[model samples]
Target: MSTDQSQGGGFPAQQQEPPGLTEEMRPQPDHGEKSYVGHGRLEGQVALVTGGDSGIGRAVAIAYAREGADVAFTYLPEEEPDAEETANLVRNAGRTPLPMALDLCDRAACDRAVEQTVEGLGALDILVNNAGYQMARDHSLEELDDERIDRTFKTNLYALLWLSRAAVPHLRKRPGCIINNTSIQAYEPSTTLLDYAATKAAINNFTVNLAAQVGQDGIRVNAVAPGPIWTPLQPATQEPEKIEKFGDDTPLGRAGQPAEVAPAFVFLASPADASYVSGTVLGVTGGKPVF
Candidate 1:
């Protein structure tokens, strides 16, 4: 099983509503269901992954389980089926799985996610703020409405803050870490996804600053900024034309798959591997630059 697989990028035109499902995507993304052999790097740890029902979240949850971590994850109510599948994968790997149907835009829900993960899984060692939101537009200035901006920021940025704040005390005790899911769109902003891009750039700032503040307490903070990856988010949010070309802009000449990006999270969360690594962004960008 390899961590990095070239997906050959282009996809047949498809569409779905917000918070898309894994089953609906054609050529269904490989969430490391068969690939990603782990070496017990995260043994005995417990992790809370926002939006773990599918895409990078599912892949990360699967990787964490295989690495021996008990996992709890959050998803939209509409994403229940996808969440169940992710839960089954964790069980198959001999770990606990807690799936919560949640809309993370609520501050209370963010706090609850951490509390439940600790109570259910026994402890919280890794927190992956991987849930995000974005929508493609034909005219960014004309069509980007207040509601769209608010939802994008609330989901992508505000929830990250709420969750991390709630998780800090618990993490300090275990000397655990936080890994926010950032994006290539941060550095290379998309004209259409203005709100989403802004939040990602803010996340980069937040990740580094939080790492510094938490380091004294033995808590590490970092982020992973992925380039165009073939996750359900593409079809659900992007314009058809954009989805058709997808990751071709990358030097790799194709978009990446969820499986290919999971290892970066595992590496960042691994104490033996990343104990001294903090306040940095790991790029799984298919030849795109994160810096």
Candidate 2:
């Protein structure tokens, strides 16, 4: 599926690719440029969202910014342009944006991202552990290489652990919240994405346990498990044939947009709507069975 269809020829066809930047997407995902209306749900708050340069992360950043929060995000080395565009959208929403590039798999880098976000944004009120990667392998566990398994765990699980640990102290001080991005695969495993499913399951467990530990400190921990959304990751991770029919089997006939999953983050981060909500997983998987 070429993501380069022409829109009306005036504004250019926006890219709709998953896991990639809004700029590169054929029909760009909505950033609520003029659509999303905010009423100060998160005013005066500060948020740090990993992978905020694109996809669901970008949607959350824009929503947070619209709600009057300063946002900081981390992206991979090669994703600078998309990262900047996300920042610009935040600024356009009348909020501050701090764009940083770092490899979350590196413990030191994760710590640095936390520290820099706190220093740059003044205070961190919300932390969104949204960065992740996966590879589809048809091999069984025995045939899976140790290296691939290790990498998957490192990126999807360990990175969240390290980043959350680093952010906890700062979060504790402000009674902040943490929102982890999990996957529907955590509940229903896909044969091809064995390692990815395992990591997501770990994330689900981590969110529950961490919420219990942090509840006393007034820190909330939660997760969102999204089945399949249109993002750059689809094309980058799956085969073209799979990409063409993405989300076709879901209860919703078509795939979801990034905008649809982002409001869950906004509600979880905002005290107004989720003061009593923690240790819960919001399933945004297009009416898929979560239980």
Candidate 3:
């Protein structure tokens, strides 16, 4: 079995896997499989996490489970094994893991995901909007394709709005919370990820506005803006050369692990840790500037 560090990058020539999840992925992502210590921060709550099969989503799911919340997660059908692994980790942490496969880019699918999560887990006390996609390009503004821009916006922004809208009814009943996965690039835009960065900025705005709108209903909404973290999206979307140097140049001098960022979700979900917190964006970008 390959250790976590060995699975970083550089797979064998014979291994060919899909973009989302592959059995041959080296150092398979650490989904809190064997390591994740919990402290019961979220006992008796329910959480729904999009893209919860791997990366930060997986980490959050496991952490939520360990912290005493049953979790419902979404992933593509093609990533069944990885999704199952996440569910299993949640089970090991003593929480039920309801894993569903759905394409969140569709409004109907987003609604269904929220519905199914509520049906399976009883009620949703927390929502983690963590699914996203990005492709790097060094093109000028004039060269950017309209389709790519639209797709990025649809996946990163529109789906979030749709899902949040659908879940608000249930959230209102229980006085729940939402935590969006924004990116550090929202503040420090990358030349290659223009559209992606724009969507993240929009996410920030949406989170703040939603928090204010729902505060009267007792629903807290916040966001987590992570900087450079080692996740599958890096290798799936970037060039191999760029992959090799992932997270090396961050202010922290290294990319953060998903485990390191998952705690923020736990903190925001629990009223004990964040009773007065709402409409705020917690910066977890390895010491990056917020402005």
Candidate 4:
């Protein structure tokens, strides 16, 4: 990372194919490889993070393990390398790591992921719906076809519903919680990301409604709406030109690192810290307004 780019928003203009890999990114993303210190906020808990193979999911998985929680994360079959790296990080934190290759588009796969987490880890305390998809610079609505639209909804919204439905029963047993990964696009809605933005808005609605429906059962539901964090999602989804200034528009003047967002997941998953926090969107988006 250059000092000039260290300022946050002045990225050196980069790009990658859809579903980019962390290792290939310029200025490798900082997933708290050494700096995140945990104080047992989630001691003895178990977590299932979708997209845990890289980016924000990897950060959350690493943080959860350090905080004394066993972690089970899902990734695409092609993301095995990333998954292995994340598993190593979790193990180094003195916690168990169950990395599974899965396709979230399949409803059955979503159900099985939840089952595997509880069955393999002994219990389920947290579920992080962090996996998503988006195609950048699809300027015209006409350019957005049925396949892209379906894929966007299935990956971002449908899988969330499927996973949440499957995990809710287990969560009710432990009185656990669900944390969703939403985006600033939900409220801001860039024309280029029409479908992605719509799904995020739907996630926000689902989070609030589900929180209300399940509150009496002692299972909380919430979301994190990040503005512009430098992750695989950016290079994978945005145009090369756009990638150069990826998060420069934020008030903070730069994109946030994955490590910076991990703490928010920890805080929300911690009963000691957020017992009364539910149906809320925690913004980690530099300076963008989530509300």
Candidate 5:
């Protein structure tokens, strides 16, 4: 019930409209623009990261490009500004960047995204299902509306299936991988985020099953379960007061930054690093047990 005090932990009260902009955050998130270094672990590869305009997705795009992989990332319409910035960062790494503006709730959009990545970048080596939607206004199911619940399911779950299904064929050819973004909420549910937590738990199940289904194709499927990360999503979706005390309950007593979660995605996508790693949900939480 209380936030433990950490030297660099805690956020100030802030608020933003839906689909928040990174520039509007009080203490801007660190997406490894300057800190991440490449070692050519993913040379000549192409990656598709959903929700890559900002947050963990942007960090992964930056890291993937630095690692010598061309990246095609997706964003909502309102996120063009952030998407442009992400694309430029990828370019700065001397790798091609394809920034796709999409509404993943549409099945056609999901297929086209994968199609464009292969058509645009030549091949698809990694697919990151990182786009997620959640709202904090509902305290109970009685308070939850159909529109909000449907949007949550469609954005977090349906789009994952649509994108992965379309990408699997391309992934099979290159022996590529899929890295889904799950959350600690999968294990520890919050009353306000019941729908989001539900979808995340389903993602854990899907990751493991999909890995089993495609292991024969030499394709690995895994997920990253991050705890409280300092991303634009926080201020956009959470109550301002709650934002100030975020991540205090973690064993580390601090929230993680987007930069901190990118390496996990890179590790999973790298063939040499994760040749035998599949069906596993890797925890990037601050000592939170994903199990």
Candidate 6:
């Protein structure tokens, strides 16, 4: 609520196992619940946001519903409680919310998610590839094991590919759009986020290339590259010491809330607002450059 840039100036030192929960957060991250007034920007749309259980995905799902879209979203099976809460938020917005528990690393599951959205929601208008994985082992290349690398790549990159491919046919029918969730880490690489950052970079390339390929069909593709926004990912992925100083280095000097980032996704999804906007990476960072 205060743009003073002092809120969450530095987080209280905390940690959580991977895939943290919102209720477990110290100062819970905002998901634009009481805020974010809508103006029918995405009216009549049907959106599928991966990882809609919490964080940026949750915020986007809520915003989309408020903007008049029936929404379907995915989350890890273990995150069902969080997923239910997100679905409730969507329902509060007077839109249908289909919450599915999924393991994105499973390629077949990714395909099934797209299929379920199409079948359940009636039509697909926006696809937000927002689910991702990151862990800060702070390990050297030698210590970063193959298993972790595989999981990171599979979750962040492979799932995007699988889901997008499956959704393309449906997207083509509605001349829909695809919005990928990338990160500033793609440009400013962090050694600890080696695999994650690499996948984000690949996502950027994929977004632009896909836009070009789909433009003639009236389908737009783009990405949102967020900086150190406050999300479950931070507590779960960053070292505890890093968490205390999270987002302090940003020009804004505080971590952004999920509410702060949802507008970007809203803008990119609304054809009225961004019909000509394709092959673009909208940076919602707190003054971090994604270039």
Worst lDDT run of 10 residues, candidate 4, spans: 1-10
TM-score against truth, every candidate = 0.98, 0.90, 0.91, 0.97, 0.97, 0.97
Q: Which segments of model 1 are wrong by more than 4 Å?
A: 3-6
Clashes (N, CA, C under 3 Å) per candidate: 0, 19, 2, 5, 0, 0
Name the weakest run of 10 consecutive residues (lDDT summed) in model 1: 1-10
Q: Write candidate 4's Cα lDDT for 206-266 as tens digits.
A: 9999999999999989999988887888888888889888788888888888888899999
Score candidate 6 by lDDT. Answer: 0.90
RMSDs, each prediction? 1.1, 4.9, 3.4, 2.1, 3.2, 1.3
lDDT tens per residue, model 2, 20-118: 555555555554555666779999999999999988888889889999999999999788888888989999999999999998878999999999998
Spell out the clash pairs found in candidate 3: 7-26, 7-27
Residues 1-291 of candidate 6 have per-residue lDDT tens digits of 222334856798888888998888888888888887888999999999999999999999989999999999999988888999999999999999999988999999998899999889899999999999988856678877899989999999999999999999999999999999999999988888888889999999999999999899999999999998889888888888898899888887888889988999999999999989999999988888888
Pairs that clash in candidate 1: none
Q: Pairing residues by index, what is the TM-score of model 2?
A: 0.90
Model 3 weakest 10-residue run by lDDT: 1-10
- Give the Cα error of residue 107 in candidate 5, in Å: 0.5
The C-alpha lDDT values of all candidates are 0.92, 0.83, 0.83, 0.91, 0.93, 0.90
lDDT of 2 at 129: 95
Better of 3 and 6 by lDDT: 6
